[model samples]
Target chain A: MTTKFTPDHEYIRVEGSTGIVGITPYAQEQLGDIVFVELPAVGKALKKGDEAAVVESVKAASEIYAPVTGTIVEVNSLLTNEPGLVNSDPEAAGWMFKIAISDASELDTLLDADGYAELTL
Target chain B: MAEVPTEDLKHTPLYERHVTAGGRIVPFGGYALPVQYPTGIMTEHKWTRDNAGLFDVSHMGPGFLTLNTPSGDAETDHAAIAAIIEPLICGDIAGLKPGQIRYTLLLNESGGALDDLMVARSKTPGTLFIVVNAGTKEGDFARIAAAAGNKATLKRADDNALLALQGPEAVNVMAALVPPAADLGFMQFGEFDWNGTPVTISRSGYTGEDGFEILAPAHMSVALWDELLTDPRVRPIGLGARDSLRLEAGLPLYGHDLDETVSPIEADLGFAVSKRRREAADFPGAQRILAERDGKLSRKRVGLLVEGAPAREGAEILDALGTAIGVVTSGGFAPSLGKAIALGFVSPEHTAIGTKLQVSVRGRSQPAEVVPTPFVPHRYFRKSV
Candidate 1:
């Protein structure tokens, strides 16, 4: 039920074995405008720190790394039509995908809200 | 992106202003410049298209090319000076009229573009203003200066600062500060005295939208920039929007779209090779350039409307059978077009408008179609008189 963060600037909102993942607001702010988001397909197995998705801005493109090892169960296809939504509401509606957590212990390796806020600062 | 080494980077006159205005400073062309302001590049780009955007372009090499010997008759002196510079570039410099500007390319002996630049003829006849790319300025100046010998003197105006005010509302803003600036037709420039310092303003810019470029003394430029921004119609822009604007305009950037290995003909800049220069075949690289004019080039620059992910620079362009035909030189989302668009090179056979192709983005082939460029129409001011 708590949100955890990674040093690479991804967030995982834990919900049982399924978790929703997205990039942090700090990452989006640094990225400027989000012109395109290339996400992994559903059922794609991803390892922790693996290249999970891509976020492209008007200036350049950056890789979005996975925070924990899991398999993508659902993707936020809404990003295709409205990429700017990530800039507007990166935390909620801009969530990139849902992953079926393969290992609960991997969540411990990530930072909590307090730790993430400090890391961003 | 890799940070440009801090040791070699320089700062412009407006460097402090950019920091004060919440600009995301980055190293570009060996200068510390703002890539975008707090409003972001997309907003700034739209502002320039609909209203006005002010850009700091002091990093560009803006200097004067004047005759070392002053002949009493200004007309005669200018033609002679133009002749000295004409031999070094592909443009017809001798045919330029007073207050006119011509876009041309400095070429290598093998017909490749050294750098694309703008040459502006001053009304004073013996003098001409030259603007070159920041990255190539040092070498370009040295080359031109060495070639000038005693006939002309190439004065490197590092003390000057350049700014571009672009948009549909650009004229309205410039007219308020200096009325004569609005009267200038596209590709024309004139000097005006405002307050105490003189400012050279030209009805030319990189954006496809109508605009004016102002050249002023380095010390006086900050004041002029402040004065222009006081107008409610104008917003400060950064280099991020500048690249997108020019790309949409179908303008070739020196280092990216053009380089020492790419010829002007292959880059789709044949118009810059003047009518007289074509017939005379007298300018540098004219022999190979003229030969390429009639003959088929191996590849050509073309615009693409990408259907999927934005195809970026260096993406491989593919033909119908998934064969790599060419590579993209500059590609990104066109803010005005509201779709992903790209500029890439392809075999001549695949360059026709509406020709279908594919671009490999992240190892997946995406659908692309060749389209007529300037992805947007240019709106330059043309005087009736």
Candidate 2:
């Protein structure tokens, strides 16, 4: 599955009407060793670019932004005991939540891998 | 851009190296040191815990105190100088053998700690080498100088640079550079040469591991650091890991764990006070210190393991009923323990191990328990060959 990334480092993988949302590899690298992750509850609705979750490191905490308007369908429950998964595999197994897309057309607004890399650089 | 007061921010010789290594420089103890590398604080902290980490602590004050005499015969009166200096601190300075190092505290007239420092008795009889906190070094020097008053001379070794190589593999990595250093026991120091540069190496470190603190000439620090980095076992660690490592080892940072207002007795640093000094009562704060040592101290420093989120400095410590009882002096998430821990000053009544308490962090009261320090077991090397 192709994953699109946002300028702010959030990534989204569209699967029909649902999307798998997580932070990008670059974001995880920058955030360092993840100690805790606070995922939004299932069924919670979020607007595009709204604060969706929280990821904490040893030294600081950061807010995760929603890439598109959606309702949370699933949250990564493993994060409570093994937040380091976000650092180890931010792109794959470290996916934060799955969302039921409210606006599939909004996916066009996000950046592809190349564009995300350029923005990061 | 308008200029602000940055004169207080001192830079070490390796400041540029830090920037190039992707270190996040921050002002600490009046010096600009790397708080974290590009990997970030958590990564650096975990790396240091699991593997060897190099630290650039060159900004700390490294100096010597020379015993002075009317006839310019320092060796003749070396014992007197060591004895005189001992009164101002709570270490067995007079009993320190040649090439011995001891962690000690500088006390005020009220028995409060002015600063906690490391003093090393060099091979030279009249010279006592010392390393003090960068922020309080000037004041510590002035206090010592004034107290010594012509009995000893305070000489700042500004040409030297300090580096800490810490973690379980630190000894092996450093041993490759200084072969004989591998056998040196903890708290023992000696002069050695690293690639033709004379260096003073101490088998002691803030991290709860077997490590060495190498003090070399400022010009050679960068070269040594680069050379150490070439080894796969050693990775450059920033100040962020250094702080967490020391905190996990239960070591106290100067301004946080100790201050001019907190006495050695109150800080639970009584081990530093020798029995001889206690009996003599000749030190500056001997009278009050002795009283506190005899169970008269009102407050005592203790460690706390907190539940929930991390508790930061200045967090209010509360009783079981949520009443304010004390304040956290230093608190943070301990990476190794995978939990939050804190050091705080509580009433002596609440200082016992396992005493239950609560800490208020971010407007929430979290349960905490009084625990013994070195929150993690210290892994200092004590073997002598």
Candidate 3:
């Protein structure tokens, strides 16, 4: 399994043909408190940079874009009631959705954990 | 055009204090102010609703309008200064009782709002202290100086710092700091000293909860702030929670909810125009503003109980037929109400409470209803018998 990050601050944990997607801690910190989340429905196909979801804090709402092209296989329905999970555990239990990776070679373009951390700094 | 550096942003007296306390500083109204602390906006907001929250509002305009030449008599000097201000704003300043604070709107010639401000009579001869929005203060000050600067000296107390101690436990915290402030009821201001620091406090605040706004010399703010936080009931709040608090209180924020094109009547701030001024209609834009007071307004500001996503500014307000009727000025999740509530302007026909409407949130229509403001009931402190 390999965890990759995009410059826009989204992360994807890749395992074979599937990948789990979520935002990085740095992004969550900038968002302050998360009050609402709207995710794309399953079977929706997204292109890289497409606005895939929306996360709202008390101050304002922001869009989360797709890092790689794929179809959404599953979503974190739990976020509908408890959006604070994004602030609590953004990378683990707070993962937004699972993407069925259409292009495995696209993972090579992403930054590793250390690379992303350095990029943020 | 060259980009402005963050270093160019002004810092308040509480900047270092906020940094030491782990506050997340953001650019706001030409100042680098804290948006939240390490505990985050949610915790800080909830804490304020339950306890006292101390806020640094030094970036706002805090100044006094005094009679350029006092008659040495309190009544005569006050009347003289009030007469000068009466022409610029829609308030009956001349009729204001000493030591009283009145929330009023500065008007344009078209009866539109220039800014909303709080004017407090200092109870002393020739003094009326006022506070205006941070972003508009420069323009507001210029206009005030031009309109009545000669007749009534406009003293921008830029050297002073302002703070707001808010929430249910605010009075308790304030009383511990200054005993005299405890006797103050709602909207009453008094000058006092704290550890020899000249301070003016009023039982008035932007939050719907009971609280007070204190102003003192800039050099004295840090000492006073540090001392206030020594009490467990008082925690430092940020501008993030402050916005939510005022929004929940249904108080319109200038530049967003109010502007040059919006009138006091259309913004639902009719009460800010004093009852005496309403009949006389002597202030600026009286012909149009007073004419609209009879309920013939084209649009009216109202509250909304949003069912789904939070509707932000510029969101479209639509009728049942998917026709746009109005636009949202301010909208957010009300922490106290535990739901998304918004303030917006709609046509007069849709102004009635319980009138069903749909707010287009990011192009998705969300069910909403016209509700009475404030989203959270105001708990202002009133004197006990």
Ranking by DockQ: 1, 3, 2
What DockQ results for candidate 3? 0.57
- Docking quality band of candidate 3, CAPRI definitions: medium
The TM-score that candidate 1 achieves is 0.98
lDDT of 3 at B56: 93
Q: State the DockQ of every prediction.
A: 0.68, 0.23, 0.57
Query: Where's the lowest-lDDT run of ten residues in candidate 1 chain A?
Result: A58-67
Clashing pairs in 1: none
Residue-level lDDT for B217 in candidate 3: 88
lDDT (Cα, tens digit) per residue for candidate 1, span A93-113: 999999999998999989999
lDDT for model 1, please.
0.89
Which pairs clash in model 2? B90-B272
| Candidate 2, CAPRI quality class derived from DockQ | acceptable
Residue B236 accuracy (lDDT) in model 2: 88
Residue lDDT tens for model 2, B1-385: 1124545787888888998998867788778887788877766777777778999888788888877763445445557668667867878787777788888888888877888899988877788889888888888888778867878888887557899998888888977999987778998888898888889899888888888999988898899989999998788888777888888888888888789889888888888888777777777688888889889988888999999667778999999998898999888778888998889989888988999999996577989999998999988887653
Give the better candidate number (2 or 3) by DockQ. 3
Candidate 3 C-alpha lDDT tens digits along B228-313:
99999999999999999999999999998899998999999998888888888888888889878887699999999999789999
Give candidate 3's error at residue B37 in angstroms: 0.8
Quote the B-chain TM-score, candidate 3.
Answer: 0.97
